[model samples]
Target: MRERRTIIDAGWILLLLIWSVTILFPLIWVFYESLRTNQEFFQDVWKLPSELKWSNYRKAWEAYGIGRAMLNTVYYVGASLAIGTFLTAINAYVLTRLEFRGRKLVWGLIMLSLFLPGINALVPQYILMRDLHLTNSLTGLVILDSLSESAFYLMMLAGFIQSLPKELEESASIDGASIFQTFFRIIMPLSTAGIVTVAIFKFLGLYNSFLGPFIYLSDPKKYTIGVAMYQANMIMQYKTDWVTLFAGLVITMVPLVLMYIFLQRSIMEGATMGAVKG
Candidate 1:
């Protein structure tokens, strides 16, 4: 049994290493390329840099106006994560814990949209945003993103809620706790794993979103990091400054990488809870 377990662990490690290489190689290459000068990048795309160019980020940051763009990105992401996660938790709680006449139908409708291509709604969305004067505004992007709650995330939280013993809520009610109070004090605290999982997901989604900001934010200063990266890369057409572009890409990815590292435990637990319960 010991030998069998060791072999299984070794196999898993090998699989993980392979997966990491597949995902990380391109990023590593990009970082390495960011150190190369324009001429070096053009001449030796695959070769190591002769010197580390720490100044690449400074040039990229100034050219991209990434400071203001990053600030805008932060506002967009922070608003979306805060609003989306709250609404999702509330929606999940209602669907799983509360009784309603058309609960099943409501859930069914949400589920049906799961298979629909999100791009199909872009035209209508753009029109609506234009009509509402939400275009070219950060608030508009946040509001739009917040409204489109992820069905999968809601389902994950709902599953976690369902798995918890109802007696906890019952006990709270016996102590004269109102529904809101019970949710805030009892359910929300106990469902931290699920909520944290959903928050991390929404954070990642908002952080990396390209389409929403790309379509809505016409102002360059209001652009997100993703859009800024696109702009930086586009400048390469005229300037051939590939190093700056790579540096911009690295900056764009850093927040996401740091967030994942910080919340990985909660994310794993929440994901596993949903899978196990459902």
Candidate 2:
């Protein structure tokens, strides 16, 4: 039995290594390619660069407008992350912790969206944005993103909130604390793991969102990193500056990767502890 378990563990480790390589290879190759000149890349795709051309990143930032797009993404993502996290936390706390009429009905209605495909709502959302004259605005995008709650996140947060002891709320109430006070002071701080997890998810999704920004914003100045990279692809058809594009891709991925690396502990704890009710 011991020998069999050891073999099974080894098999799992080997499978994990393969998966890691599959994910990391593209990122490493892109960073490698980003250091090469376009001439070197086209001459021999497999050969290492004789001299690193770090200027590709500068060119990507200045000529291709990646820097501006990154800035746009930061503001778009930051604003929505703040709004969405706060709103979702409060909503989850209310639904799970507070007693009120139609709570289950409201939750059911929200969860109903999870059953339907998101593509079905795109046309209607576009029309609403256009009608509101919000199609070309970043603020409009922020508002839309903040209000559009994810059922999965809501459920995760609700689970976390439900697991909290009611004794805390009762104690807070004995001291004449209001619902708002209890939530802001006690519940919010205690639910840090779940909130951080949700924020990271929101941040990553908003930063990488392409279709919404593509459809809503026509102006180049308003483009997010995803849309900017897409525009770079279209321009590359004529110019073929692969190295610069590679640099731009690396630049786009770095911040999010670093964020996930730092917060992965919180994310793991939240996902595990929230599910283990007993």
Q: Which candidate wins on TM-score?
A: 2
For each candidate, what is the lDDT?
Answer: 0.88, 0.90
Give each model a TM-score: 0.93, 0.97
Residues 1-278, model 2: lDDT tens digits: 99999999999999999999999998899999999999999999889899999998998998778878988998999999999999999999999998899998999898898899999999999999989999999999999999998998898888888888999999999999999999999999988888887887888789889988998889999899999999998998799899999999999999988988888887788778777841
**54-133 per-residue lDDT for model 1 (tens digits):** 89999988988889989998899898888998899889999999998999999999999999999999999999999999
Clashes per model (N, Cα, C within 3 A): 0, 0
Model 2 poorest ten-residue lDDT run? 269-278
Model 1, poorest ten-residue lDDT window? Answer: 269-278
Q: Point to the candidate with the largest lDDT.
A: 2
- N/CA/C clash count, model 1: 0
lDDT of 2 at 36: 98
Clashing pairs for predicted structure model 2, backbone only: none
